[model samples]
Target chain A: MEQSTESDICTDPVIRDQWYPLRALAELPEGATHHTRLLGVPVSCGVTRGRPWARTESAPGDGGTGALPVIDTYGYLWTSLGEPPPGVFEIPEYTEPDRRSMNAGSFIVATSAPRAVENFLDMGHFPYVHTGYLGIEPHTEVNPYDVEIIDGEIWATRCEFFQPMAAATATGGQMSKYTYRVPSPFAVMLYKSSPVDPERRDVIALLLQPMGHEQVVAHNFLCLLDDVNSDAEIKRFQQIIFAQDKPILENQIPRRLPLDPRAETPIRADHTSIVYRRHLRELGVNYGVVPA
Target chain B: MIRLYDWELSVNCYKQRLLMALLEVPYEIVPVDFFPGWEHKSPEFGRINPLGHIPVLDDDGFIVRDANAILVYLATRYDPTRTWYPVADPELLALTAQWLMFSEGTTNTASAARLHDGLGYDFDVEACRAGAHRLFRVLDEHLWFGEREGRHWVCPSPHPTIADLAIFPDVALSEEGGISRVDYPAVRRWMDRVRHLPGFVGMPGISPPLATSPPSVG
Candidate 1:
């Protein structure tokens, strides 16, 4: 086994140029200001008369009113440290009129953003970490999922699992179908079966802000077409799930995730994670990920 | 009228500022150069707080020295709702006091590490970081189970007490000190809940919640 060193991984420039969620749209109230650091740059976001704007202080721009591009979409404030490619990723499900949009809140993880993204992509831990909720012991089998890289995006389809408590309003066990998509290095979204209507799926997006080499803030946005549970109950359900994964992710040695196959052993269940790592490697995202 | 000896970047000062904002109490700031200026060490400033600290709160000539102490005093006196301090309920009050002390541990470790990194303060940075992580792990577990039990704050109260304000600044700013909250997802969620509080204010490095309704995804 080869050990990955800090020198083996360097900050990749490609990650900074892409847009990531800075704050939820609801977080930036009219006339209110928010300060955060994106890809190690100071950013201040504010709303003016129902319009939200973000300015990177280090960038060549005037104070507050500068040449910074800010967009409000999918219930989040999206911005980039560098010139973003055109626009943010589009989620057609967001256009659905009946979907209730919720920002589950932002989380700060000590590990690299890549590690957090990979964890979000993994379903093997569901049985142990989210026991009796997302999964249970007897239902540990993970059917092979189809993965593909289309137009610089990683997609995992046909993923299914038996979830004990699929949602806050869930009554009993049910098979949940899921499709995971990695639109950007630090952003991942999942279209999973809705607890209320199994035929319908809910869109959950985890947008991460890479604070540094080993630090990230994740913004969780959920678009669900559910008629039962209140928004608060839904938020709490997601919060509990994320809380279980935090300790496991942080305790992983090397802080930065390793892309090298030899760095850590993987089973068939990590197919989505493997493909996701390959895509990251193709993009040269070495900032928070060790090189192969 | 209340007056606070404050520093813009000090997490301790932020605790007082945050609580005052939450309580909607009007207080004037007596700015102290806590960093390179070291105004807190000056004789004139020392009289206000002999301990050479910022966030010394004075309400009608009654002086409160420490950050946690100031939170208790302001919440007890200024919070007309009587929910911030929770003195009416003995069990809840005890838990608040316990967590307030926990905040002191974070100050010594997390805030101490920040002082060493940001202001060139002399201290064992590694030890401070280690101490902070230990404290954060405990807090994360407590909060994780608290969420399970349907309790949001440190105590069982539906509303947040001063303990939440007392510990939040240090935890939120732990990254500057090289302490990561990544392992503490429950703590991270609690941070958002704290930021969402009405009239919540933030200091440098501390972010306030967005002004719209929190997202409700199932």
Candidate 2:
């Protein structure tokens, strides 16, 4: 128990004081309460009167700091362990009625939340990890991408890669354009070209719910303009791609994402990951990160 | 056409699929909803194989149940060279059978732990993991020594046999059950050897190493 407690996600202000996804809205039944760990503290969450809420058990003499605020938005129940930002970061495309917003799937990954986020930011692994779907070798090189913090959010633009079967709607290989956003340490989103609706970018967001410093429940949410494929097929395609990444992510040398510049070698293609790690450092995020 | 009652994630089922793929034996998949659906345990499936397990192969109505049994049947019937089953050489045949038997230990321990975590089965996970680690240690030692003897596979054969495929899934996907292979370098190298084999196909949680840059199959 002591070891488990010690290994739970660090509880520093920057890492803990932000909203994290608890579960998808579809899975939550109204009026049920249960406790689950968040940033190392057990918080009870339930839906009441169609409003999801979360609260923690405060010991005596701790005052009234037990009520952790909860909000339901974009098909998930979100809660904060401490002070969250003004609102859950903006996702303008989700409001479009024709755009289908859905849950791709959720997986329990035995690595730090940051590792999962970094994997989303990486396209070099696509040729290898995602294989034929997102990329294939001989065409494996990732074109130069721009990474910078815009208004305090990490953004990577101008990223592109060639993929065989880019999506459920993909009929053949295409040079897929990619844009990435890291709104927080554990959340990353990708805007890739919609194979069916080439004019519109498909949104795939991976949010990490940190169960511990070295473990997380990764929730994949998709907002896409694709009407050619059924929801089930879309989910299946995303799940297959993610399943391939699972083995590689789990087999990484260290379970925690190393923030130290010298810890892991970086190449030109890892520009986004390198920038994201720097952003994490700027935020003073030590949870789920290797000590320098 | 041969039909296999298969689940993509099951190591036992995957071995049959892997062997068939390696043998280049084109077959149809009778997808069994083994997880949330539990179709394999149904009365209808019970008629196919009373054991209520998957990887039950029906080759033109000749039914073969169990993973190893199907492997034995396929290698004997399909391989013209007969290098896989080695029926002609008694010594190699005994060694192949020995490793195939050892593969079951991996299934019961490592794969059982995966079932508990991934599919929510009732299992003593700690015990399962401990048993798996014990088996992996012995496996690592064996592979390490075999490399020294210039034997690339579990069986001391010039070519890989059914035993390699049988054990590959359980050992490769051990991390799905939180069993890390970091300590077993020799075992890791052996899995890579299996992955680089022509016609190698990966199920969920298994993929060829990125450096090998092989295969379009995800």
Q: Model 1 Cα displacement at A217 (Å)?
A: 0.8
Q: Highest TM-score: which candidate?
A: 2
lDDT of candidate 2 over A103-159, digit per residue (tens): 776666677889999988888888877777888888988889898899988999999
TM-score of 1: 0.59
lDDT of 1: 0.79
Candidate 1 Cα outliers beyond 4 Å, as residue runs: A1-13, A59-66, B1-218
Error of 2 at B210 (Å): 8.8
Evaluated at residue A287, the lDDT of candidate 2 is: 91
* Candidate 2: residue pairs that collide: none
**Location of the lowest summed lDDT over 10 successive residues in candidate 2 chain A:** A1-10
Question: DockQ of each candidate's interface versus the true one?
Answer: 0.03, 0.19
- Please state the error at residue A92 of candidate 1 in Å: 0.6
lDDT per residue as tens, model 1, A1-292: 0112334232466876888888777656589877766665566798888777887665222234344687778878888766678889889888889988878757666678888888999988888788778999889999998998888889999999999998877899889999999998888999999878777898888888876677677777889877877554566577667756765776679888899878888899899888877787888877787789
The C-alpha stretches of model 2 lying farther than 4 A from their native spots are A1-3, A7-9, A25-36, A43-68, A85-87, A95-101, A225-233, A251-255, A258-268, A290-292, B1-10, B27-104, B115-123, B137-163, B176-193, B203-218
* Highest lDDT against the true fold, candidate: 2
Q: Compose the digit string of candidate 2's lDDT tens values, residues B109-155.
A: 99988876654456898999999999999999999998889888898
